[model samples]
Target chain A: MVQINAPMVGKVLSVDVKPGDQVKKNDVVLTLEAMKMQIKVYAPADGKVVEVNANAGDVVNTDTVLVTLE
Target chain B: MDQLWEIFGGIGIVHLTPGHVVMWLIAFILFYLAIKKGVEPLLLLPIGFGVFAANFPLTGLTEEGGLFYIFYHYGIETELIPPLIFLGLGAMTDFGPVIANPKTLLLGAAAQLGVYAAFFGALLMGYNVAQAACIGIIGGADGPTSIFLSANLAPEMLGAVSVAAYSYMALVPIIIPPIAKLLTTKQERAMVMTQMRMVSKTEKIIFPVLASVIIILLVPKSAPLIAMFMLGNLFMESGAVERLTNVSRNELMNIVTILLGLGVGSTMTAETFLTWKTIGVFVMGVVAFAFATASGVLIAKLMNLFTKNKVNPLIGAAGVSAVPMAARVVHNMGAEANPQNYLLMHAMGPNVAGVIGTAVAAGAFISAIL
Candidate 1:
């Protein structure tokens, strides 16, 4: 399993993938908003999401695990 | 009867002039605009109260050893508050769009034509070179930059220049649209720009340091404003100094803005603001903005003539230093032309670039004049 961490301090605006969903490399898995800017966290590699750790509207810090992929 | 007249004699009524009452009315109008019209309340509110406070008969508020005096001396005349405000603005800005499209820097540079145009206009109107340069910067549409230049080059005209700059900034929504629509066709307005690439974290982190080094090396006169601005951007992009970013963007920004506005407003004595030159300053300011908007759009059209990729000329109008407000005006105009179009992100490139470009232009004027 691989963990995906939040890259910046921001509110999680959306979770685009859930457990059992497939994502391609570079596909946006979640969106975060910081300093009124939208930041998209992309999938590092082709994978199936195994866990989702954050919800929309959750304020997150850098490196907080946001999802897990298998 | 003699006692009653004598009792009131020592009060301020005898010394008050019609000009003082008119100044009071102007202050109240500013208050009404801030509260009711929501026209840059953050700035207009403090400025309105400062004008009212300064006009209290024989208060000395605008004289030596007074509150407004200290604010103007320590904060504005010393050139401290404007740079601090730039720091906050830098922290709040996202330079990703600018990084994504480097060509938009031209739009920023193009918008500066307004400043030069206004400079010549002021000069023709018989203002000295220093005063004309200060008046011209009102075209930059950045209040702090206008104030900074005015304080340094032509301290006497600071009141008129600052008022024109801020008032035009607040009027961006109303002023930019008509000019933008008049300049572009429906096809040009609806031109859909491609999405900007995702800028990497390394690039984001390096930008401020790199920009500071380059800009300062080229125009050392702009060092104070540019240095603080880059430092704030670095703090945000580094992500290691979250507290610094928060404070820079929030508390520090708010405090500096209040002091800055009050300091500027206190300079507006009836003797300064009531002149025919003041009217000329305001008139030239509109001309500057109109020309700035036109030039941005025209430049975009010119660039499209040379490039395969077409840009929406509307984004050119966003090249003024009003930041997101100017960008939003561009976006709305694009949307009006085509509902599916999203030009906000693209317009932001020139919007932020205008901030840097304005600073550079101010530096050029400073270097040339003084």
Candidate 2:
């Protein structure tokens, strides 16, 4: 299992995947808005998304786990 | 009957002229753009009101001892408000990007080519060098710098130049994209840059002091804006002056913004704003933005020739000092080309550097021309 943390403090613009959704390495799983720019969060490795800890409009920090992959 | 006529004669309606009516229309346009279109409402709303009030003849709003006259005289003419605005800006800015990638500083400096381009453009159009310099700084896309430089070199052109600067800044989204598209190929725009190294708190804290010493030492005339700017940044980065940082970026900033807006707007009287020279300023303003945008992209591509880690040339458009607006524009363009590309942090380096670059350019102009 692996937890995908936010890269910085930002608002979750969207979560592109949900529980059980498969993602390829470097595939965008979520988008975060910070400093008035949209930043995509990509998967570090091929995995199945096990959980989404955030939603659109949710403000997040660097330690906040945005997704759990297995 | 004569007494009644005398009373009526004293009212603004009796003193209104076609020029005053035209100015009212211009003010309404500013209001619509601010309230309706949501374009730079912070400055434009107050400036629009200032235009509306100042045009009301016999009100004395812009006359000596009047309200706006006081705002203009003590706030802008005295060179107080713009520097205060810089204080707030510095407090709010995060220099982590620039510190992580110092080479982006050159992109910021290269963007100043637009300033010089517009300077010569203004001169060729027959403005005196002082007025030309004021017009040239409009390309810097910094409202306060434009106001500061114009207030010193060409107080007469203050209204037109500031309005031009801020208006163009708000239009960064519209202006940058087409020019950025025109300058770079799709492949270059799609280049993905690696994540920048993390900057330390110690580096952030020392940056303002070191930058202040170097910039002020090089351009002594830039001391006013640069001094207050670095001081405000110190208040933020010290981690011990949250109160001062909060006030500098918030309360004090709000107070000064109102004064700055009204002060700039009060200068937009019918006599000063409605002229052929004012038209020239608007024309040269767009030229400056285009040139600045093009030069930044070109320089980035030029730098790519010698560097090992290639830069996405589209980030160069972010060097126009429109803050996150230009950076966001670059990010969007990058995303459109390659979804995995995150150019915001990368673009921010040049974006913030552009602010410093523009200030230094203003300082240089003051040193050479003043």
Candidate 3:
């Protein structure tokens, strides 16, 4: 399983991915906010979502684990 | 007229030639643009004041031991001004995003095409290589970077180059959009980018060091600017240096910005500033900036052709170093292209990287000149 990582230091605005949901290589798993704007987190490769690690209102920084892909 | 000339000549400071007075008015107009138009006022206000003070007959500000004169001579002429500006800039930048997305570094480098293109363009116009490189750095929209290079390469044109860089920075909002629109279509603008991966705090904290090490090794001349910028980012991310970071960003940055602006303004003495070269430098600045923005977008468009992932060409325009302002402009334009499109975060990668890229280019220019 490959893990999706957070790309910046910011608060989690929301999670777009869910556990056990089929996802594409570039599908956004979550939105992270920083510098007064939000950025989406994309899957690194094509996979089926196996687990979600973070949720809404989470404060995240770079390399924070967001999702695990099977 | 003889008596007036004699009285002013006794000052041995300001020549008060007719050309000098015209330059003073020109300097005032620059300040007016800063204050009224809300363009890069941090530097422009003091620069304007400096010009006004320097131009008045017998002010004694720029003379040896004279206070403003001392400010100019000690700081700018001696090359202390640009580094101090870097100190403040280091305090002001946040490197979290760039560290999180290291690939964006490529975008930053891509944006520097403007600098190279303008450099050659200047050469075509009869400027020597050093002078052309100095003028080319204007596209980076980074003040200290431009000043640092110009001081080393083309000190004779320092005033014009500095003014051109700062003025174009203020004009980033105005200059980038048309070029972006002209080069890109609506579908290309509306294109959404995959979200960036989260950058860990540990990674964030280590990023400045790692980036500085890597970047400095690749471009040694960029060390001063890059090192200082990385130091500021370190202070911001270290958490242990909260007080230092706060002071650096707020008090240090604000104070230096004021002095730096004024000191730079002093360079705009009427006699040297108002000339055909001033017009040439200004035109060169716009060309440099335009080319830089266009190059970024065009590179993205070209890359999109090979990649099916669909790169948004609009993000390329953010590759210049104007920071969030240029990124925000991209966001606004992207939304205009398609209401559902949000390019802000994606735009930021290039925007922040542009800052570092321009600084590196400045470093490269200094090296070539030296």
Candidate 4:
């Protein structure tokens, strides 16, 4: 299992990955925004995106999961 | 013998009086304003219901062992509720607009003048320092913040302070316009603004972290409020933290609001609420808010004299923490002046800035007094 971690404290401005996107390590899978700034969430080890945990405009705390990778 | 017989019959006995009825009517009016007029109903509903419940004859709703008593003892007495509310508030706020255009903080700063002004006004009206402080907080126009201050400073005037606070908040839509119009000329209101730079995703992410440090370090008392707001904004901006944001903005905010609303309303009772002092507080509150709004617009116009790029003075109205309401008002008013003007997005810069400013001003007041 691959874990998606919050790169920063922010709201999920947009989710780039759906339930079934194949991703490589360090691929941008989600976008997070804080203070009007946006950031992309990167994938960990190479994996297929199994489930996305957040939709766009959801607030995320530190170290929260953004997706499930298998 | 006749009085005793009538009292014993339980027929001539009325526990609630005309004054209590007036309070209940006021509470219902609040409900109507919230439901029909869209004034902070999330809070007005619980507060209104609590008022009605407490005002009902012989209910003991706020007495010992009552649920409201329990809530008051647990939170309001210790000043826990306001700070906790600030936490959820922090989690829900978007500080980017304020950060992108840091100058709007001054509008928020200007609005706080009402608070201090009310302080002096109340003192002259014969209230001691503590009572005057409670009365002054009505200018802040935040229910919890006002309740928190009154709970700390003057427990005697809780009902009056709470009513005045919420009442003025409801009146914001009506109260701000005349002041807004008076402060800015037709030319100032019709002025166009340079489009704000589309803040990058990276800048948005850094805002909360950077601001928490800058603001909290400057005003430690504001840590709870400013920190919480920035944290909420962080959650909203963080791509990875969806669940937390949803919880903070929705479930968490909703639940706390219910408790806060009712708990605050319980403070109002016939004995505590019906007084000439309450009237004084309400009047002073309106004057304070009007002064605050006028100060903001006038200051913006003052700034307009120097800037190469013109700014719509209407954005100054966003300095109040009523959130999107004041911001929306700025947008509408700007459109009224010029149909082609698109000020909503531009006004948001000061709109969100006002949130932070009000919290800071509250922090400053809490710091100075307590």
Best by lDDT: 2
Residue B68 lDDT, candidate 2, scale 0-100: 97
CA displacement after TM-score superposition, residue B177 of candidate 4 (Å): 1.8
Decreasing TM-score order of the candidates: 2, 1, 3, 4
Residues forming the 10-long window of minimal summed lDDT in candidate 2 chain A:
A1-10
Candidate closer to the true structure by lDDT (higher is better), 1 or 3: 1
Candidate with better TM-score, 1 vs 3: 1
Fraction of native contacts under 8 Å reproduced by each candidate: 0.00, 0.36, 0.09, 0.00
3 versus 4: better lDDT goes to: 3
Docking quality tier of model 4: incorrect
lDDT of 4 by residue, A30-60 (tens): 8777445445566757899888888887887
Best by TM-score: 2
**What lDDT score goes with residue B368 in model 3?**
64
List, residue by residue over B242-278, the lDDT tens digit for candidate 2: 9999999999999999998888888999998999999
The DockQ scores of all candidates, in the order shown, are: 0.06, 0.42, 0.10, 0.02
After TM-score superposition, the amount by which residue B40's alpha carbon in candidate 3 deviates from its true location, in angstroms, is 1.4
Candidate 4 residue-wise lDDT at B146: 76
Docking class of 1: incorrect
Q: Rank the candidates by lDDT, best first.
A: 2, 1, 3, 4
TM-score between predicted and true chain B, model 3: 0.92
Chain B TM-score (each prediction, in order): 0.96, 0.98, 0.92, 0.89
Question: Model 1: C-alpha RMSD to truth?
Answer: 6.1
**Tens digit of lDDT per residue, candidate 3, span B165-188?**
888877787898899999987777
DockQ, ranked from best to worst:
2, 3, 1, 4
Clashing pairs in 2: none
